[model samples]
Target: MAEYSLRAASEARELIVKLHNSCLTHINEVTSSLKEEFEHTLHLESDLGQWLDVLKGRVESPQLNSAHRDFGLSLYAAASGLYRQAFSSSRSSLEVFIATTYLSASEFKRRQWVSGKLDISWSYITSAENGIYSQAFIGEFCPAAQSDRDEFVSLAKATYRRCSEYIHGNVATSQLLPTSIAYDKEIMREWISLSRTTLLVTLHCFMIRYFTELDFGQQRKVEATLEDNLAHLVSVRRILDLPVERSDS
Candidate 1:
């Protein structure tokens, strides 16, 4: 077993707390700006206007249904040394964000899926064989993600594996339960870094897709706001040494 250091653990908890606050602040700022824009430019009758409504609904769903709220609670859990729960919650949030991104790309598909007329499953959405990995989906829906497809898939798969161990009560996770409540510094660091990067990238992709459907004037306004907030998110990715290129607009 790896030795645990109290001092190191405390520092890691502090770092996680700081990162959590920074991420939440940026997310709120972006969401608020988008909401303000939507209210100012209402157009419920048009196709693009209806699409924005759907985007607004999905972005707000995370908070309304507690998915985003759980992320914040997970950070508190990590700060209290509940690393297992924290990791699990992070993965859950990523899953929701991914689904939301997929849905945001198409109003007809999302409506069908939500109304229970579509026969798709979560596995199908994330599947390597016929899901987001297929070129058709990437090209037609989320071309921006194609820029760093390899990195995105690698990170998602690796983190999903690690989180599954904790969620399923696997032997690897059980072994850690008997140890000190405090998590290893490196493990906590990795979880926070991975979770933040996944969230920011997902949000950026969603925003980019939404922007593409807007007229030039509205697009410029939204893009300006996004680029301003994106600079800070990119800095966080750089500090974690994850993938700064993934943040490119």
Candidate 2:
């Protein structure tokens, strides 16, 4: 009985040692992952800074007007880069990492299954859209007031949700969210088309109301309604331009 008890004690010690070793291994892996992330973020920020420096030069070039189209594309890229980092930075939690990885892999598999296309590059679409919106004109029209900036940011968040839904092959014809006023010009092609048509009519009605010289309270109401309704009108216009059919294949 004493020998059997000694044998059990030996086995217990071995298990404890094994557990300690496993814990060490886990700690090392987590440390390595954090280091890698730190280095990656540092490199990303450095690259973004370089892009900003180049943009500053591009902004001052005498031929800027002639190159405005290309300039616009570059600006979008820069903004997208900054946004990518910003978005991913907030997702430092383990759940976010797991969720993003699983979602990305699932989406990739779905794309392959649907189209038989296996070499899809997700970054290309992401970076291209970002580059397009990063232009000089966008900077010129950026809201200066804190309240306006906050509203624009909210709109931007909503627009991003719409874009994500469309990109993910999930949005139904009737479900797309409204486009926000805060979007860069490069992102507004569909809205631009609507603005040239139905949207212009709405704007004309609002302009007449504003310029007609109503009483103070009436003018305030008109102004408030114009501010609130403008985004809705633009979104509706954008909705008109989106394809009605879902492209699963």
Candidate 3:
């Protein structure tokens, strides 16, 4: 049996922090780009920071306006999906892992953690589970013996359960609300910022785990993987620049 090393874990931690910061930066850039068109008075970047301040349970507001609520939820849904795919494990069915671990949840079936209703026509939790496995990438990079791969998959699933519970379940109870128009703007910005940051951290861990599977030297691999993941994150930001679209028919 192999023991986890502090040095590798530390490197991973640094990378996760960097990823989180990079995500904030990307979100700010995009928000600033759109502020002029939206005729928004508040600087979205600053609004996001303020939102985080409130999320610490410092203050509370009355009901958030529908537009802001919907926008924040939509961003959360998309960001959650992107992060899960890059970093977390596949969470197709709650019971899919319940047999292996002592965990069960009904919310996984109903509140599937995406922005809107989690379906095109079929009932599927595509967002949270999308790109989670990366079977092809894992096979190519983290190649392992059949038994070892199975074990890795199981562990990853377990990790997903833990992380999801923390992020999706716990984070929802945050005491913040959209009070003013500025508050609403801040809410959207903050959600976007946090989502990107979380995703970056996740990718950082995933890449380090990837290198470990290949028995590669940790220090060099960590640096290389962080850089690659950052670039990928930038590309993802561009792809999501379009306005949020949903239907109520």
Candidate 4:
């Protein structure tokens, strides 16, 4: 009996050691090979900081704070090769972010949410009829995103569902995600691409809700990112009033 227990303990220690080594190896691979993709997402974090820093007082909602922190956590998880955790966190951030804007119009609703009285409605937030991305809802706050309503809404819904796949461990994802910690270029590529998409979607939603409220100086804080990431769209150029560099006319 004693010998068996000792052998079991040794095997357990070996498994633990193997797991840590796998994690370390995967981290090295991600940081080295995916440097460009990872840094691109980091840039979004910088843009987010500037946007929040300028209006920290007004945007002090707990949900937004949680969402921002989750975005960072998602990046960390991705680097650590925890793919499921990374996707889950990113999806959560998406939910809270859009929910923040959904709750913005009503202080009472916001307060109720803060006090645990109101629940965020994902269906309503993404409702094709009147949700945040709907023509009517967006036209009220952000005309720039209005023209591209279907595009943003579709991207948002698709990404949300994709992340849920990892979370729910659906049949396809079950086969995709390895049973143990390991580096997978394909999955890593998928995640990096998803991260950028999530960042862009969130940025659009954020700008839709609050960008115009910023003074020109404050807007300039995030202008570079918007231009770099969003300038291809004529609607964005129109909203920012950039020069007619393109022959959209």
Against the true structure, candidate 3 reaches a TM-score of 0.24
Tens digits of per-residue lDDT for model 3, 33-150: 5555232322332232332233232111111122234334434332332333212222322222221111111335324422245432211211223222334433444333222333
Per-model RMSD to reference: 13.9, 23.6, 23.0, 2.9
Candidate 4 C-alpha lDDT tens digits along 7-37: 9999999998987888889989988998887
Cα-based lDDT at residue 183, candidate 2 = 21
Off by over 4 Å in 3: 1-183, 215-225, 228-249
Which segments of model 2 are wrong by more than 4 Å? 1-55, 58-144, 171-249
TM-score of each: 0.55, 0.19, 0.24, 0.88
Task: Report clash pairs, candidate 2.
Answer: 75-134, 76-130, 76-131, 76-132, 76-133, 76-134, 77-130, 77-131
Best candidate (score: TM-score): 4
Clashes of each: 0, 8, 2, 0
lDDT of all predictions: 0.54, 0.32, 0.35, 0.82
**Best-to-worst ranking by lDDT:** 4, 1, 3, 2
After TM-score superposition, the amount by which residue 104's alpha carbon in candidate 2 deviates from its true location, in angstroms, is 28
The candidates, ranked best first by TM-score, are 4, 1, 3, 2
**Residue 184 CA displacement from its true place in model 1, Å:** 3.6
Best by lDDT: 4
